[model samples]
Target: MTQRICGQVVRVEGPAFRVRGTDGTEWHGVVRGRLKKGKRTATAPVCIGDEVEVTPLSEGQAVIERVLPRRTCLVRRTPLGGRRTHGKAPPVQVLAANVDVVVIVVPAPAVRSTVIDRFLQVASSGGVQPVLCVNKMDLVPEPAARQHVAEVVTPYIRSGIPVVLTSAATRQGVDELAALLRGNLVAFIGPSGAGKTSLLNALCPGLDLRTREVDARGRGRHTTTTSAIYDIGGALVVDTPGLREVAFALDEKDAGDPLLLFEDIAGLAARSRFQDCSHVHEPGCAVKAAVACGELDEARYREYLRLRRALERSPSD
Candidate 1:
């Protein structure tokens, strides 16, 4: 007779999963066919940090029977040309489930506001708190360079998001970062070369994960190829592979207004004279006025428009 037990999926590698059972046993498992074929919009039915039921077969192998409902999930739009249903839009990719926070890490001297905005939207939409982690501060040793980085993140700070500047090599701001992550399940995400793994090493000290240097073009070489959960200090940290693009999946209801994460813009929009103001050529648009008068960060406003247009073009299937 097979014994059924509950476990949390700690790592996902293609069709294989590593689940840590409630009894402290580790099981290598695969999802049941029925669960895999369910009518879900997610590319994969299982992800790291998911609670699941498994039936132990023999040795350390098990079959994942069911996935418990997720309290929160981090997701992104599947890349174009992926598997489609009747030529419909691509499904979303579930990155992690039941996460308390999504940390968007970016390297100093190369901060990209567009990427940060996209990640913020997805985290907010998924009901997870978002924190900005500026890593590799050692790369920006000059005072002017450091100030430049500060200016880049000022808008996010003004929007009430927590921003931490860290350098894995020098241990700068590691204590503060650790404080925010203590006792919480946090997922670190960012483009390649942002030092997610390095920060993890700095925080846990001795779990020396792999590290790769950025290319000559200043692009990060992929170091972490898979997503996995680690128990670091008092925090459960999920370290994921670097992402090149962060397109978000949106529900039909959310398609009309994609500014849910942009509080500054949303607040201004509420005061617009026209109820349906697009903030582009609409007369008396509060958002546009704010941008023109320097009341709002112009770069952030431009990125918001870019994201809105991208969402408008997204296919809802």
Candidate 2:
């Protein structure tokens, strides 16, 4: 009989994976022949939150033989990075598996609705709940900064997305965030310098994930290189390295109605003169009218257009 043990993958480093067994023991494991022989098509055969069968090879060592089924997975086509890949973008990178909620962290002082929209699309495309977490509230304590944060998150909140204002530096809203994530597996994602790690440290209290200051350019340096999962009380949190860009492979069905992704805009679009209104320069377009009347945030409308164009340019378009 094989000495097989069931475990969840906490993180992956190159070809090795850190798996924590149901017995609460962790072991470094390598993928066995089955996984390496094209069992899965993802760029990364294994990812954080993956449940797998590990066969112990020796003390404190094991080999992953089979990956159990995942309830949900967050994936994105990674942009070109580091080495040249001959002009082709990398295959779908599985950010995490079995995630219940994807907390999209955005910094207030430098929030970009485009980034938030892209992550929203990715989360919905992967069948996961998306939460907008505005981190670094400490930087926005002043009235002007507070107003900026409010303005940035207003659209998302109106769209029915859960928005949490957090400040890892001052430990503000950390308790609320913890409660929201309790009894759930959540993944924190955002651009490089959005304070994802700092927020995690604040929530867990002793993880001490490395932190770095945003440079003079107002961009955050990469402090997390690999995705790692940690058990904070009853909640499972996965912290990932900052993403510079996000892409979604939209097909005809997906691209046919980009407005559907924007809840608030979609509601207005439902009242448009045409059933198939593109919401761009279309006559009697309720969505456009909302933007003109100042009922919708112009920035969000522009982001909608940009994402719509991106979808229109998809291979299926």
Candidate 3:
């Protein structure tokens, strides 16, 4: 008879996963029948940081019996965008699982904040913390660009989320960022040239992680080809391939709290004459008033409105 137990997966190796139990021992195991049965909830069913039930078949090997209910899941949208839901079902894509924080990295000087906004919106929709990391600050040479970065990230910080500024080159803010991810499964996400890998190298040196130069337009070549987790002392950090696009749609069920993500809009939205006010062009919109009265940056407010629109157009009805 096999002894059944429960553990959390710290790393996913080819066919075997490194699972650590509450007792602090390690087991190399394979996914059991139940969890292997294809799940659409996440990009990868056996993602790093997943808590699973297992049965030990050997001294160092076990079979995963079940993946326990996750407290938080971090996911992204498909880049191809062929599916349609039109009030039917959500056209969502899963990226990872049980991530306490979704670290959304973005290159500096991105005028639209599209990359950052899109990731934060998804994190908000997934009930996870979106930690905005503006990487490559060392490369952003202009004062205006730096100002834009601060402006775009101010709302999230004011709302109690921590936005970290980092530069792998000078090891700037590396310790602070590492502390945030310590003891929690934090996923690093960003487009190709946002310095995700560089930051990883800074935080965990001696690994000699590969890095490529970002093009003139700030596009970086892919250095990370898969989603892998690294153990730093007692913490787990997941480094994934460079992302090109972040889907704006989320599942119809248990989608994240939009009000919480865009908390600033709540005041005006509730007071609007229309219960269904989109807040874009609605009359008597208080959200708009705040922006005009120097309460919010024009760009930041626009990004919020875009997120609200993306949510509305989401495949889930």
Off by over 4 Å in 1: 1-3, 81-86, 288-303, 313-317
Best-matching candidate per TM-score: 1
Residue 130 Cα positional deviation in candidate 2, in Å, after optimal superposition:
1.3
lDDT of 3 by residue, 1-317 (tens): 77789898877756678888999878888877656566554444676678888898878888888888878776665555556545544434556678888888887656346566777777877778778888878877789888877887776776677889888888778888888888988888888888888888888888667888978866788888656678764568888788787776555554433565766667657877788676678888777777789876576577676666666665443
The collision pairs in model 3 are: 43-94, 125-256
Of candidate 1, the 10-residue stretch with the lowest lDDT total is: 80-89
- For each candidate, the alpha-carbon lDDT, in order, equals 0.88, 0.83, 0.74
Q: Looking at model 3, report the run of 10 residues with the lowest lDDT sum.
A: 84-93
lDDT, model 3, position 155: 68
Which pairs clash in model 2? Answer: none
Q: Which candidate gets the maximum lDDT versus the true structure? A: 1
TM-score, each model? 0.90, 0.86, 0.84
Task: Please rank every candidate by lDDT, starting with the best.
Answer: 1, 2, 3
In model 1, the Cα lDDT at residue 173 comes to 96
